[model samples]
Target: MSSSLRNRLAAVVMAVAAGLLGCTPASEPGASSEPAKPHRVLNTTAQPEDTIRVRGDHTERLQAFLRLRYGDKAALDAPWKDAWEDTEVEALRPVTRRVCARDTATADGQEQTLLAVCQTLDDAATVEPGRVDLYVLRVGTDEEKTNRGGFFAQLPADDPLLVMAQRLQGQYGRHGSPGTVQIAQLGPQRRAFQISHEEHRRGHRRVWRSYIAEHNHRLRDVARYRDHLDNLALHGCDGNPADCGEGVFAVDFNTTVGDSNAVEGYWPLTVRASGHDCTGPATAFYHLIFDARQRAYPVPDDLQRDGCADS
Candidate 1:
């Protein structure tokens, strides 16, 4: 077997073992306030004494990328220390998914490899749980140039994707439940990314925001909707306890994205809900059409809100 394959298999095994052993870091009472002592950080660059060097492998590159990004944060030291490079904590490690790879002709008409990668940082504790980041790597023949330009370059401040991410971060506080990143193919040559944020209050709620890829590697907001909502509090059961079961109302919608046959330069989102309420079992379907001028898929006003109202 190839060395790369073996390394990947070993990483999978280690992640599984770590999960089984429950080595995830816990939020200490005072760990966030105090700065942790300096420790050896993973070295991605080639050095005389370094044992392993990160080259083109995405997994290795992601590990090195995260260590360089968050290794120095004093607040994250405790949980970061237990991550893959330092110790064993699956939740604290970086999770990566390859979006796509394409060979395109450059200005000089030479074929260049472009790769899109999505990485989620599940800090477990300290702060920013399930924070996701996207990267576009331009692979070249020169290792030094590729590493310097692709791995270390930061996303521009005005980038649409970064802006949307920041908005979500502000909407959901640091201690909010971990969010998830997903990729969907809208058409043969078109693709989009969906960011889902879940929160729990008296009830549970999940919202999905979709962005479509455009020219110059930018993303445009396409759709936003609530896919899950549940209210655990019983209502409309004042007289008798038997009706309490029917008083509970919860809604879950399954969303699917596909190429839009009706609209040009857009995609269609289908939301199907199979839920129950005091009224009885309820089912509904929403075919959200994209508004080109508005550049968004308008969801029903009722579905846009969270939680079930007491009737």
Candidate 2:
């Protein structure tokens, strides 16, 4: 029931299969190098004067979009200069040709949203017929600080990978799954498949580099979120109105998104607490994000300190 227990459980449940929960790539056959039209404005932050161009290769589209968002100073990760935002895509099977993103950073620093999109072009592919069209990645953040900190992506709620990881993670927590679960039990959560999806993919430098990056992200996210779980417990209903149940904390996931080529965004968890006899729960957002090197822990919401004194 404690936050520490919950975090340990979550860490055990999730191997941090990050991209697994992120949006996927869709391949095109004989498709032109020109970018496709907007499948739908997944989400945007550009002012009315901004020009959103969704044509050309994914690299060009992302660069153009960033320049539009951050002005001419826009520059991408060094390794990804030749591709879509430093994304490593295999060239066979669901061979990805490009990745792109459109984000907003209003001068006022209002809430911002980053939409990282990907496109795959393959000669022969039927795994997901017609799934090759552009669609927002399932995990993302639309927060102002998240955007300014360069950690936002358009990860949707229903991504298959996200669902799988959450299901595995949900088994954790006091009322959820057991705390002793192992990563291997989660079914080879790594991106590389047991079967050889691409013969030449193993040789690509980008592929291996991306995998290393992904592994690092996983380690960082698990440790960070686990720490969040441990710390949130300290603020439980410590000296609250007696009628409320003891330490009754209810929580739900806000989201997980790809922020940039380097660090991923593990958005805050929407949480609230109250006792059994209490009329309502005190709500707040708890974020435990992992920057390229470290995890930023969650702090108190406005009401956390005043109301839940005992917590």
Per lDDT, the best of the predicted structures is: 1
Q: Which stretches of candidate 2 lie over 4 Å from their true place?
A: 1-222, 226-280, 295-311
TM-score for candidate 1: 0.48
For candidate 1, what is the lDDT? 0.45
Q: Which ten residues in a row have the lowest lDDT in candidate 2?
A: 204-213
lDDT of 2 by residue, 1-311 (tens): 33543565577556455456774445578768886432222122222112232445445555665454334544544211112221223221222322233333321232222332232323333222111111111222245223534222232322111101100011112211111211111012222110001111111100000011123323212331211111122334334433335443322222233333323333233333322221244344444333434443233444233222223
Q: Candidate 1's residue-wise lDDT over 220-275, tens digit each? A: 56666676655553343333323457556666678877655745445687888776
Return the top candidate by TM-score: 1
Query: What lDDT does the true structure give each of the candidates?
Result: 0.45, 0.27
lDDT of 2 at 282: 39
